[model samples]
Target chain A: MALTRRDILVGGVGLAGLTVSGCAGSPTTGGRPIPVQGATAPPGSPNLLVIFSDDHRADHLGITGEVPFLQTPALDTLASEGVRFDRAYVTTALCSPSRATLLTGQYASRHGVQNNLSAWTPGTPSFFDSLAAAGYRCAYIGKWHMPGDLPDLPGVERFVTFTIEEGQGVYRDCPLIVDGVQTPRPGTYVSTDLTDYALQWLEETDDGRPFCLVVAHKAVHHEFEPPDDLLGTYDDVAIDLPDEAFTYQTLLDRNVWEGTAGRLQTSYRRYCETLLGMDREIGRLLDAIEPVADNTVVVYTSDNGYSWGEHVLTGKRWAYDDNIKVPFIVRWPDGVTAPGTVSDAPVLNADIAPTLLDIAGVPIPAAMQGRSIAPLLRGEAIEWRDEVFYEYFADFPYQVPPSQAVRTDQWLYVEYDRGLAPELYDTVADPQQQVNLADDPAYAATRQELSQRLADLRREFT
Target chain B: MSAAAQSGAGAMPGEAARSGPVGSSSGRAWRIAAPAVISVVTFLAIDLLLAALVGRPWGPAYPLSMDALVLLRMGPVFFSGLIVWPVMRARGATRAQAVVGILATPLAFAIVSGWRAAAFFPPLEAAYYSTNPMVVGAIGSQVSSAGVGALVYALWRARRHRSGRPVSSGATPLPISTGWSWGPIVAIIAGTALTVFAVIWDGGQHLFYPWVLLYGSLFG
Candidate 1:
């Protein structure tokens, strides 16, 4: 059945009603939370620390070697001591949709955050609900850009996020909403301030019960404002932009669409500098968790990848690799048997919730669409997905068409709405996706198969 | 004793020499080009001013509302005719020449800025103009604002004529009896067609494909 605009609005209201009524928690199981397949964790479960950044490209990390000049020592160290899924991507390449997918372990369609304008369906089951029920203290920190106001999540004991500037919080002196109270932090950078709050929670939460903390940073997003000390860190480095980038692409993009002003190279340098600032904060959080490192799980990733002029685009929501792929590194000393293992298995943002739930020995909810990669982390032989599906809904005021794509180890197939032509690329031959093979006779069979598979995945997930 | 008659009789010596018949090709060209130049300058001034106000000076940050910035940028385009009208009168243009100059201001501003915007990635351009509400709103604002500005200028000129007040520092007003020529009309039509052709050529399928879809849905 086709979902009309009315259906979406009604569904949102119904979900909000459920949230207000506190229907997420059950009275029967004594709140111990029975797992779908196995026993729930007891009092002392491993802590889960998920450090999520905004718009950090998959290749910008120092460990990735994709950008040699990029300096991200903290992320590099984390990857060195963890498992980096080199091909991890978000199901949706927009910030709100991808973040919703991360929390819900479901696609944007199922979660009802199909665009930035849509909010998280209030009663939707998140890993936080499961973790909270299973004797874990959960907290969501930093930027919540999803519309319909900052949600009152049942699972989160503390919600430290901002609503200033319509949830795209300022880079400096950002206000904070700490557990229902508005607090102002004057002259503090957003990344540093958010990380400081995360550290404070970690130090103050002294209960023997484990904790689930999401430190979602707003650094590296648009405006690309780095902290004062790291502002000009990458000013001298030569920016390696794609050949498709026009001379005035970034200038027109900023002045017209984004309503800002900057050239490509300057904006890119500021983006890298901002990432460096976030990296320093991540280093602080890493140090804070060192005492409990053995019994903790640390996952580092971004909401979505940003484009620095690749395909002549400057922002996210495109199905291109620069917009969808993200840096996914997991370090769990107690869970991951092998350190420094770079897995070739494709992962999605949807998998993060299920994986964290599985690590905490909490029940992976039956409604969750993603499969936990816990066995893979344990170095156990397990069957994994061969391809990942991606979806992006059209965001108003931003001109990117609604698109769906299926990416495998060897190919990527994309279909767009509004009568736009489909795109198909042989990943092995064209990693940059410069050529479209949808109409090529030699790749006709491959395109047909991938198109069918994409349809199948969409039906199955939604 | 109309305002135009008073201005003609009280003309300064230098103004009398400058205010000649609109039939001369060089004089007509200047009349057309002057308002167009003024329109472009006004637009650029507004764009730059807004950029400085909301945009971060030391870095590549714009922490303010984007909707406000975009709306503010449209202000100069809408009132462009009024902004260029005083300059047209100061140049001692005939009534027909002044009307042409006022209409040309918004057209020139729209075409120049639209061309720059269309130079973005073809697919992005197509997607943006694909029946997007913002595009519709912007176009509507431009047309209506220019129309309103022209109407106000015409009303003010009529009121001044009826009251028999001199319009400005008096220069000889060219005769309104000057026969209408096809030159300005042909130029406007040719300029619009060329811009359309250039945008279509540059944007290719990315520009045309979505419009085809929209047209098919609307008409068929």
Candidate 2:
């Protein structure tokens, strides 16, 4: 008989049922799942806990010393107890595309989620599938903002997410979908509510099998709505607006270009407050998993960085450091040899999946473009890439142009489409990228070299 | 003589002699229609100029960008009533007719252009503009400014009528009046002060810092 989609789906479900039942008997085999015949992971594989935040810039953390007044004790503690990647970035600075890179361990160009409007490429191999096939239970709980309807993602046993406001879930009282069932959660803050679901899943599914939990928070993204407790937390804090942000022309330009309504200072305060709320929830999750804290690998990072009045721009998707850089913190007492160590080697969001899979003892797929940073965590002195590549496709209705960039230790080169002038900044001399050296005769050789390197990297990656 | 001509004979001297067939239905329609057309043209001209200044391409290619541009454009629509009020009053319109013409400017512009915008954009995009508090506030600001302009016009006309001076014909009349009440003056002062405050407070440190430095030099 010819097979239909329904038949395939039902057959897959039946196979999954059989697999679950087979593993049910050996749930508690020496603090790990017994190698059920074809299982890939051995005994004592660590549980994976990934807490992903939205639009969190690299310098926003209290430990970064960039934002002195912004208090983020929980993230500071996590960084102090684990490895913090000092030069972490997203290949694409938008939300959906960067998230797709995280899932597939591939660039946005390969994954086909190049913009916020694009959905995950169906049938693409994800780390979740690899981990599940290797005898690990995985649950994804939080904001799933890809454009197409919430996907029936294979290998994710529990899919708890929301689809309101085009998947940019509300900060308060966001309705959720738990295991494909509509669940209303009224008066619950989204950050707290998602963490609660993560904790609940962790508690109920503690069957001695290693698990992967992703708790993605919708805080610090648009509307800048913090919880009631943190609403006025930063109102008294003085906001030092950038020099470029002090001009009326800059304010008018940003207001029209980015659709940002209020004062940048006020919106930035609310953003910080909302981030604090998200950090509080992260602390709660950390406290809940204290029993297995030593055995659990917690990875905390944001999908992308946000530009807060940097270069007179508000919001992300630019090739600037404020937009492409993200805060990457990983904690695993069992795996990482050196705690409180910071690696200055550049890392991309695409590296996250392969790194997690490597930590879980799953073989890294050959197709994943990102390299696992397991050696860096182990304090092994290995050769790493000296520069990072960044790409941003212009999403509709946003005035930003499509651009590609390459950032090295000393220089940052950016090329724009739509006839805009390319930009080159000497990071050693001007960290804020105030002076453009693209047209300067002095840096002509540097610009040419970086441009060629960018072209080569795009060809090699794509 | 026809009834229209007979009625025109008894009308105000400036009103009957200013233009073509002043008492006819078409003339009355022109009274409202002309100002509405002028107001929409003025709005479009300003939008086009601002779009050019901002380097926004002129098309429906990007709906949200256009929506934001439209919202920003609405901030200056307050000047539409201010611009048209004098023209309507100079053309022998009474205070009621002038106010009606000024009010209908924004209403007519919104209905016509909003319909065109909706046709080109998606329903969700339209709904975003309608439901956004900032966009709603812009609309409110436009209407309130027009209302204030009408009230000012009415007060000026009342003061002129009480002083027994003939309203202008063919030339725009200044809003100057003798023995004018304090209500409109207070309202004007309060509105101007609020506008200045909003610009300074929300305009980041550009306008605010200058005022701060000035105050410090003067008093600090």
Best by lDDT: 2
Q: What TM-score does prediction 1 earn? A: 0.71
Candidates' lDDT values, in order?
0.68, 0.69
Q: Per-residue CA lDDT of candidate 2, range A21-137, in tens?
A: 222232211111112222645688888888888999999999998887898899999999999998998999998998888888998888888887666755678888889888787
Best candidate, TM-score: 2
lDDT of 1: 0.68
Question: Looking at model 1 chain A, which ten-residue stretch has the lowest summed lDDT?
Answer: A12-21
DockQ, each predicted model: 0.06, 0.05
Roughly what TM-score does model 2 have, to 2 decimal places? Answer: 0.73
User: Per-residue lDDT of B128-188 in model 1, one digit per residue for the tens?
Assistant: 3433322333333433443443344444544555567433432223222232334333434
Model 1: per-residue Cα lDDT over A269-352, one tens digit each: 888899999998888777666667778889999999987766666788888898899999999887777798899899988999
Fnat, one value per model: 0.00, 0.00
In model 2, which runs have C-alpha deviations exceeding 4 angstroms? Answer: A1-40, A247-259, B1-79, B82-148, B151-220
